[model samples]
Target chain A: SQQGEEDPQALSIQEGENATMNCSYKTSINNLQWYRQNSGRGLVHLILIRSNEREKHSGRLRVTLDTSKKSSSLLITASRAADTASYFCARTSGTYKYIFGTGTRLKVLA
Target chain B: EPEVTQTPSHQVTQMGQEVILRCVPISNHLYFYWYRQILGQKVEFLVSFYNNEISEKSEIFDDQFSVERPDGSNFTLKIRSTKLEDSAMYFCASSEQALLGEKLFFGSGTQLSVL
Candidate 1:
């Protein structure tokens, strides 16, 4: 199974604090993407970082990829209650398929 | 701001029955996909379609499963026979291109319950 695994299956933080999640996969990948799912809702694409890139940022979200280690991390800075959701990391190898991780449940307390 | 749309937010069916889940992907998107997540489990890929044909499919997408574009705007997944283990949330997704790093827009999903 090439599915990625996310550490710290759950995390809790205050509104003003930063939250981070890590993902590790078993095989090489062409790119990695992070997505957020508000309970019972569709996944919203957050950001994507290619294997050649080290880091990318979008508004309050930051993503880092390390192809050498087959691992990636997502950081949400200045988290808010609205940021409370399940975050998943998906890796795409040479195919169109995206293998998703187990996901990290994040809770942002007011 | 186009988005994928799925019909029948929830469906309940008995084992051995056939059910077809429908989805309408973004208007301009060329790539379409179906994925499912069993309760308390990670999301798993089912199939990917492009050029009106299946480009890739996961092991879970066995003979019991089939996908069809059917028309210009609708994509459908038909389960030949539903089983107790078939209960899951099915999500439809689409992207303008099938490139390695392109982002996919997903639909809200349909929760299927097999009894």
Candidate 2:
């Protein structure tokens, strides 16, 4: 079974607008990480938030984690067409394995 | 910056044939992992290797699947018999164990097409 599942399988926004995607997981995790994938490519690590941390940011990417709710959200501010890609949330279980969500496809229109 | 690298960016094999996918992890990393993603599906963990042995593996890694670090730099995943359902993008990742929070760096991936 999948441990995490992302909401709104897909999202589209104009450049400069913000894009928000949510993910919900089923099990307790030590940490959560978000990744981006261009079409037909490998994943690129974006941000990671430990269970103890409520929020984290890197450049235009911001991630928030609410362990109580078993959910997390990733926000990309001032989106650009180059930012168009598929986003995935990966939850690290105690077993040292990461289970990834089905992912949300984001398209930033210029 | 160091990066994980995989060979034969794409591979094609016939059903029942053997296939080997290779990966070269970052020189300083101590942990190696393999993941696969079927088209339109989530990335799935197949196996993790440490100290020349498998640390963990998922059910998807059946008897037919095997992993080996033949030398210091090359990690290989071998499938005894290919199946059409096995076609997917295989990614290799590595991380430093000494680092408190291990952040995996992944390779570009090898697209395997089983026909």
Candidate 3:
């Protein structure tokens, strides 16, 4: 699968700390999104940033996209135990084919 | 909040057998998609369906795999002859619009194990 790659395949943080993960794709994208998946569960959409937008925020989650570099980063501020899950960055252009990046597995200790 | 729902949370089948994973997307969603993830692997797109026809499919979606929206609400992915490699977590997702940009709401997924 020639998809995207995420850095720090895994991360561990304590509650109240911040966790960040980066994603890079090979193709052009019109929009990108972040998704969270609990262990053995379905993925839930978190946030999305368009190609023109540099940053987007939703509550404690912040996402930044760099079109020039074809990469994006997700930041979870004041991480909590409930925020412990795998995060994936998905990219899509003007087509139905959406590609997902390798995910970052975060373990938040209480 | 509306949610996409998949049936038979888990399935165990023998090789060469046929299996159909079903999903019922949110009533108003217009676009549907199928994705699979092998253990410890990233999610891979299989097929995208809209207006009762396939819009796009990945290389992984070969001849043995087919998708259909039998009625107004049920979408299914059928594997004619299941292979051992087909063992993975198959997820059904739907977006309100395939208008090129929209977030997907995925089902809990059906864990298929081909023995």
Candidate 4:
């Protein structure tokens, strides 16, 4: 079964605007990681937030984890046309398996 | 930077036939994994391996699936008997350590088309 579900199956924004994607999970997780996948390609790890950490940042990527709510969010600041891709949240639960969400397709217009 | 690599970017096979997908994980990484994504669907975890053995697997990983680390650098997933439903993009990933929050390096993936 999938552990996480992402909201807003699709989003479109102009370059320089911020894009926010939300993820909700069912079970207790050790960590949650966000990934981006271009069409016809594999996923690229963007950022990872541990259960113990509330928020983390890397370049334009900001990930926040709220263990109390069993949810996480990924915010891409000043999005660029190159950032357009499918965003997915993967949760690592008690098992080693990392369950992925349905994903959000983000399209940034040039 | 070392990255995961997969072979046969695209493969076409007939149902009931066997197929093998190969991957080479990042150097010095200790953990490896295989995932599949159907068209317009979420990526699904198939299996995770550590220390040359499967550490975990999802229900989608049935008897038809098998993973092996035949050599020091190569990891492979074999489908004993392919089915049309098995057609999807198969991705291989690897992590440097077993930490809970480490990032996974993924390969470009192989598009498996089981006709």
Candidate topping DockQ: 1
What lDDT would candidate 1 get against the real structure?
0.94
- Candidate 2 residue-wise lDDT, B5-75, digit = tens: 99889999999999999999999899989999999578999998989999889999999999999998899
Candidate 2 lDDT over residue span A1-110, tens digit each: 65699988999999999999999998888889999999888788898999999999999999999999999999999999999999999988675577889899999999
lDDT of 4 at A62: 91
Q: Which number leads on lDDT?
A: 1
Higher-ranked by DockQ: 2 or 3: 3
The order by descending lDDT is 1, 3, 4, 2
Error of 3 at B33 (Å): 0.3
Question: Where does candidate 3 clash, by residue pair?
Answer: none
Angstrom error of the Cα, residue B71, model 3: value is 0.6
TM-score of each: 0.98, 0.97, 0.98, 0.96
Pairs in clash, predicted candidate 1: none
* Candidate 2's TM-score: 0.97
Give the C-alpha miss distance for residue A105 in model 2, angstroms: 0.6
> How does each model score on lDDT?
0.94, 0.91, 0.93, 0.92
Chain B TM-score, one value per candidate, order as shown: 0.97, 0.96, 0.98, 0.98
Model 3 spans with C-alpha error above 4 angstroms: none
lDDT for residue B27 in candidate 1, whole number 0-100: 93
